[model samples]
Target: MTLGNFSRVTEFILLGLSDTRELQILFFAFFFLAYAMVLLGNLLIIVTVKADPKLSSPMHFLLCNLSFIDICCTSVTSPRMLVDLLSQRKTIAFEDCIAQLFFLHFVGATEMFLLTVMAYDRYTAICKPLRYTVIMSRQVCWVLVFACWAGGFLHSIVQTLLTIQLPFCGPNAIDNYFCDVPPVIRLACMDVHVTEWLMVSNSGLISLVCFLVLVTSYTFILVTVRVRFTEGHWKALSTCASHLMVVTLFFIPCIFIYLRPFSSFSSDKHICVIYTVFCPVMNPLIYTLRNNEVKASMWKLWQRYVEGRKRTVTFPGDTDHCILPAINSLLQYTSVIISTMKDKMHKVNTSTVSEFILIGLSDAPEVRFFLFVLFLIIYLVTMASNITVFVAISTDTRLHNPMYFFLGNLSLLDILCPTITVPKMLEVLLSENNVISFSGCILQLFFLVDVVGTEILLLTVMAYDRYVAICQPLQYVNIVSMKLCARLAIGTWVVGFFNSLLHTSLIFTLFFCASNEVEKYYCDIAPVLALSCLPTYSRELVILTVAGVLGSSAFVVTLVSYVYILLAILCMNSAESRHKAFSTCSSHLTVVCLFYGTTICTYVRPSSAYSPDQDRIVSMLYGILTPLLNPIIYSLRNKEVKCALGRVISQVRTTLTK
Candidate 1:
């Protein structure tokens, strides 16, 4: 075992996991599937954590970084291992082996620190819930993540530099699949006793310390949660369980492999596989299955994905197709028929002839002026933006298609939607005269219903138009003609008008003798129906049945159309085409979710859940915020709109300069 000076070997032959064909094939299949799962599960977690608002907390953010590291680690090793498993010659160039060694340790070390940071995050959240937000802010999270990367890189550099410098004279055979300190240093012609101690100190001791720190942090967190916070006991346990499982899976095998001397063990590759393969695959699954928020976000995204796939239209080329247009049309027709039938069952009893008091959103006199100014600005911006888009669509020849035509209608609705409620709200906020003539309330209700309904149907129409354009580009022009567009737009308004009229008439039929005090800022159906002293089952039934059927029909149509659109996009072979299609659909999908989400939460439930305070907030979101943001969302999304607006602005500037 005495040292001898000699020239280093430039290549090393790896013995690999197995040489027998059957075992190699089995290993290949197992490792291949494990690698794929690692990539897929980690990628999904990364995307979900980044995209979901609910998962924007500090712990999930750290989890996202961990996922990224897992992906890097798996990519570095698994693919190369898989390639070596298939190749006849299992030799790697010296430089390649060195590079692999560097990255594997780099990413692996980073993951250790990241898991430690995650433990700290959990401890802060559980032990100091009151100050969690302030303690683990975005800046702090980013700093912790940066520290992890920096520490890993520095640690890996030291290990790599030490291992690569040792002289290897003759024995160039490596007994493992990839380069590591133990096997590489074992081939050194000189005695490696000090090098073995150094490797153990760097890799083994660090992992051991991190493992101890992680365990101590969890122990304290569990004790604290159990003693002080009984309500969060199960959630704390679940979260800690996942982290402990991952930590144990990661650190124990690493300790076993590196804690001993450089003399290799027969079970080294299997232990390495435990940390390399099993830990990466389990990280995402453990977090997703254990965490409620992540699960909820994943379920929401999955629902959207599934609903999108249900109506996906496939081409014979590479796409999967679903028949949706005929089905969507049937649903719409069915909704209309049900509404018509319900209108016939309810008799109109005209009994309202007086004024009603408005409760208003807030009664603080000090904030009245601020509220007026704020809402006034919102209303003006909404009107101007919507009107601008409407004018642009009407005048621009480039946007003279069914999509923009429906968009024009949507713009018009956005304008009218806020107008019906905002003007009265401003006047009441400013003047404190919270009374409206009964006729005014009826008119407001009628117009509000009409605008909302028409917008719903119109969005469905736009979705259908997109479906045609994407799924059947050849038939787009013929299928979505101007005549059909006109008919669809006019028919939507007509249906909305009749539906509103029937509801308005039925609402007026009820005797409102119980005080004329409306508890909401505006005349919503729920609030108005609450004032009725007579048996209001007929009105409630009609409202529920008609609104439910029509809204469901419109929602289904919109969802189905987008599903087919997505299918067509996925079928497309070009990257640019897929990007463009997704870009277009994302804006529409956002608007759909915002509109439908608020509307459903507001109306789909019983009157018992109606809180004036909650209603005001929900109404503010869909009613004011949505319309205000709609034009911005659309204009930003559509390149043509932005270009056209730029041209208009440029033209105005030139004229002014002249």
Candidate 2:
């Protein structure tokens, strides 16, 4: 029962799909394309689903969730596998495998549950059309989503609990691509036959249940469709067909692998390719190509984009809607798309961040000096941007208001966000071998959690700000005053800090640091927490509680705020003023909708249906795009800001002419 009784294995040898060099190269090429597909497809789905009103139903909601799941599920295996294939070494540490096992199952099980719910939803809609609205109302739908997630957590807890308890003091090589129950259980030195049988019911049975539910539901629905078949009814089938096809592909592969006895499948590597890599790649493509609504929406968006581009490229001599400003934003959009998951919401420094090496000579004079200079610049910029924004709002009389106050807090968070990441980054870069002390990595984990938590909290507050401004315009001053803003801002940071602290602390609690090299450049709490050598129910419990509280609370508050805002907007009488109000709110609404909607698509649901890369891009909307757009949006359309800019430009032009 105790980890103390078992000998501690430091690292693990990962037997990637094949040991052959030719196979490795071929696989790398194949997986690289798959990873790209996962990224592009998911982003396209998120953007298209968001842009279209017709695709804004609970059905598209499930699809968006699927896109996100496919993204993470692919990232879990493919990118790492691709890197491993290229390198001479193909090994994953014992600790890393455990982490992978947890997430792999967590996301996988979550998706299974989500698919079952989607099937049920379709069955209810098609089979019981009269009662569909009452049964699948917005509240009921969200509840079902909540229940799906709850089921995922409960299932994942059982599997992780079983796996982590096994004493793995034997052969370190994992036979297949990544960690799974069969491969991992095979590595255990202790008798796992009982656990294996339990898994038959656990992994195999759970999947079978979901599959049967899907099969039965689809059969009845298809029969229902046949009964009501008409010439015009063909189009209706397309929407559900895409989902059904993708679901079949996803579930069949899953059932083939999981539902069967572990020995029944010769290699999980080939199976891994199907579920983790191919399913995700296929999902976005299948959904987008098959769904007419998404295609129409994407077409409109493309037309707008191309026409906008044409206005710039074709008309060099003419100033169309201030072409210079559009030109200026060109680089900004490009940079945002390329940035990392953490840097998703903010404008990141464009300089290449080299991998940190921790060779002994890193302590030498030249190395230390270079590191100080390198990290100092990064640290200085990170601190300055956040501090300046914070001070601009906090101290300046002009900015002594709720809007600026929230912005100041965000800046402060941005400051902390990079602080958590870049310190160890510089430390590793300075060190010749890129080693981080256990204490230091844990420290970085703390910073990562706290800063991210702060940002999420701040965004929720910002949503409230918009609600007040648009909905309760007259009493905006009274409601979101200086004091209230300060309290909310403070509370937000405090909640995030404490939450992050719990997870970071858990990493050090059961953990004896085995691997210093993190797959990610910066330390993240989830990945770090994943490295635990002990039973993971405790860690997952903390994750469930924290993620549930933060993710749900933020989403609910923001969603409720918009509902009120919509109600108030509808009640207003002034047509011109209404148009003006809608215009002003449109940009903010668009940004907010993109932020929380994408987040909920992944996090608010259980881990099942969210994609890692989709999570990356969607999160990036807040992380990279929002920060860049915040300054742009606040400055561009505001008459005061535009006037200020015009004044500065006119003064420069006048002086030049003179």
Candidate 3:
């Protein structure tokens, strides 16, 4: 067991699928397309599930997870394999080989457990239809998904630990294109009999068990459908058919490869390719083609995207020609900034940071639990209230005016804004695993800024809508047309997108060679910038200059509109008219104050005055409380919204009963 006994191989040569130059190129081309399809197909599934309200069931949620895992599973090996296919030397470092093996089994085993879970979900839905919702409730679904991931981790860790510990002093060329248990273990410089058996039991046994469970579940489903010959039974059987196909394709290959000694078979590479490359590519296609709901959602999503593109391209008047050039210039500017920052980082070698540790809200155990529960509840309520508001606006024609349209957009933001931060905050509070990868932190910060920026502009737009309604009631119809509303909404989102891109690029371009601890619950611009090793004065200045110009412009527009609105309200002769007008603007005004007040306090001050604890609390005010409060404020104050919500609820009830 001692490493001093022999030389350890530092890398492994992969013979790969084919040795011919033409064959390698052909393999590369084929796999590149397969990988692209896997990514695009699975991404579409995820986006469709998230966007379509009708697909908000537990089943679709699990499908979304499956799609994501497929993407991850393929990405672990496919990219490297594709590269090696084109390279002269098909070799991977020992550490990278081990890492690749770790993630391969990690996602692979997770998919096994997930497929089994999906089978159980189908079983419950088909066999126990009466208790389906209760059995597969949102909480239960989350737990099941978490359990699948944990189980995968445990399985993969055992395999990895056993493999990494063995002495690999010679025969380091693996027969397959990727590192795997059988091929890698065969190269170890010791007797791997016991180790191979352990791996077979760990991996092969698990696959066999999951496969058997799925078979049993589907057998029962088929029997139930055969015995009761009903339309519902037939429909359930059709759904299970897709899961059955996926299980067969995924598990059979896994069992074939893992259920024996570490002996090389000529067919091993082919079988490995089936599960690793083909299964991931096919799962999304099978699901989308077989499942009507997913197909419908995808079609709707595509239509929405197409409509949005048309709206973006086709402006009202001669504005299209003017706007196209501005958009192109903005895109060019973004590209220049990104390329410039990347070059600077490369020259200075300042991009050495790998990950960040967030010093979350509180470290005390007692307070951590309290904060977790508090934020969890807040997040759930935020999602429910915002989703309800969005559904109401979409379904109820009575609430489809420009005011409700903007409100619907706000509700969507409320859902998105908290979602970006609160889940991570809760995880930090509960598990204390506050480390986020560098790319992850940048992404979180980018989205957080984008949503916040959009909300600021949206609030200003909402104020203008009110001003048109109250101050210029006669011109409101002509001024606040749907086309104009669409343009304004689109503009806010585009501006937010560019604004976030600029700030995120600028902040990350700085040297982060010092501490990588973000001193807040989640990644934010200020906390992340605070950790930079280089001077952040220029970045801070840019943030301030942009925020000041944008924020002040929005604030001034809102203020002037409100000033005119107030004058119009006060000039009303009837008290009833005044009350109606005030009620219409009250909810928006309250949200505006909450949003602007907290954001200004957090971002406008000098860095020397920044306190982590104080900033955390202030961030929660806008980040957490504002989203939670928007729906409640609007729903409680506006009778029309309340009525729309009631109608939505009744419609849902009706649908469920049917």
Candidate 4:
């Protein structure tokens, strides 16, 4: 029973997946192809995701990581298994067996953790659409990946330690094909009840817990998708279903293999092969075939290659002199094609307006006074709150960081935002003069667009800041330098300015021979575009394209940043550190939800669905309420801000009393 009393076995004989030579040959060929497919398929996924900009969401980002893990997992098990199938001996040295065991468990555990993280990602995307970007930023994603590897490494070390500690003296025949805790633990000379129990608890219990949590999370997601299906809901559901399929494939085999007693191993080798080789091969198929986006991306890539070949295929014969001549012909042909396209396009109107009327929030005489008083109070409070935060962040040395710097910029925008329209709104409500000049409307729209665009970029920057601070803390100062911060800040404003210019120019270019009265309280893009008598198809296309780029770009940036942030936070050893990190982002996250949610509702729809009452309410959220709530959200959730506010108040009181 003791180690000194037994002769340690120096080698082990693997029975392989089959015993007979014919069956082994069959197994070898099948596994060889499967292993090739696993490598090729995962490589394609990694390459496709990396190469395509359209596939730059957090979901795809994690998919890339998953594919990489699958490659590592398959490489650890399949190659050796294939070689053993052909060899007569099928023997593995003691050290080689331990090495295989270590790697298999390591990659497998890493993959398990990766899959669970991916489930959380799907949950975020489906359940919390608005906050998805801020929640799953790039910084968060990287951190999650690191944590996955770290967890896997720790787990593998424990398992390998347990298995290797057992003295293998007599029976050197392992029933299964590969080195795993289950089959190998049975060959120990001593009583391995304690080891088996530990292995079961480690791998078995962990797999079960992860599987249960994955199912539970997907259950909520399915419920949500079923109840409130939208434009892209089916795509989301398909993705979740594919993930669920994969989860089922991975966990069922794992539980069956690991959870049972060592003596219970009957035909589990068949199940083992399913996970070790077959499951990995199926992942790319499930993800790519079921996913329309990935399929389209693959198709697009194929099409581009075909088109590139077509463009490069030189006119049937090519001598050295003809190569230059062919190039010249190609350029000439391209120019002619471009000219022909331009000739077919119709002319667009480019008219300008002198003055216009604004049909503000309300026209009822009874509520005019009340409405004026209410919004006046709101405007005053918004300005006061934002200004307070702006001042606090400016003066407080403790708040001098990239996050607070961005916060200060947001506060300033919050103040300027309401100021652009609230004054005119209050005037219109009180005087019942719902008339805004054309120049004035354009000016108001310009600032609105500018501020909105700037805010989007700012949110993205804040996410990046959080990513660097949490994920790459050592390089945070060097990367997010004051000079870099200034450049980013200035760049956002400049981009917003140009964006507003393009939109305003496009808006005014349309002939507005219709009524001057605007529908909503302020001159928003959609409402103003509706009044243009001329066909605004081109203008609409331009607007949609620009807005799409801006919105989608900001979204991807934020999502990628938070993905890394989430990963980093999850990896933190201490609960208090995680809580602290989350708290730092909570305020910004809330503001992101409020801003993006309302903006998308207002602008990202057709004019046909535009409702005045609904628009006003939604407008009030981002315009008035968001600004009003932002400072409150920051001051309340952030302890530093609260303390700073208290100090400011104390200073003011002391000054007054003196």
lDDT pick, better of 1 and 2: 1
Per-model CA lDDT versus the true structure: 0.80, 0.66, 0.86, 0.81
Instruction: List residue ranges in candidate 4 displaced over 4 A.
Output: 1-353
Worst 10 residues of 4 by lDDT: 341-350
Between candidates 1 and 3, the one scoring higher on lDDT is 3
**For residues 478-590, could you state the per-residue lDDT of candidate 1 as single tens digits?**
86888678768877887887788777767776777657888887888888888887866545655755776677768866876786677679889999989987887888888
**lDDT for each residue of candidate 2 in 485-587, tens digit (9 for 90 to 100):** 7667767766776676666555455533343334444554444444444555435544545665676567656776776677667878988867776665665
Q: Which prediction has more favorable TM-score, 2 or 4?
A: 4
Candidate 3's C-alpha runs over 4 A off are: 1-344
Candidate with the greatest lDDT versus the true structure: 3
lDDT by residue for model 3 over 563-600, one digit each (tens)? Answer: 77897899999999999999999999999999999998
- List the candidates' TM-scores in order: 0.48, 0.48, 0.51, 0.51
What RMSD does model 1 have?
Answer: 25.3
* Candidate number with the higher TM-score (1 or 3): 3
Find the number of clashing residue pairs for candidate 4: 22
The global Cα lDDT (0 to 1) of model 4 is 0.81
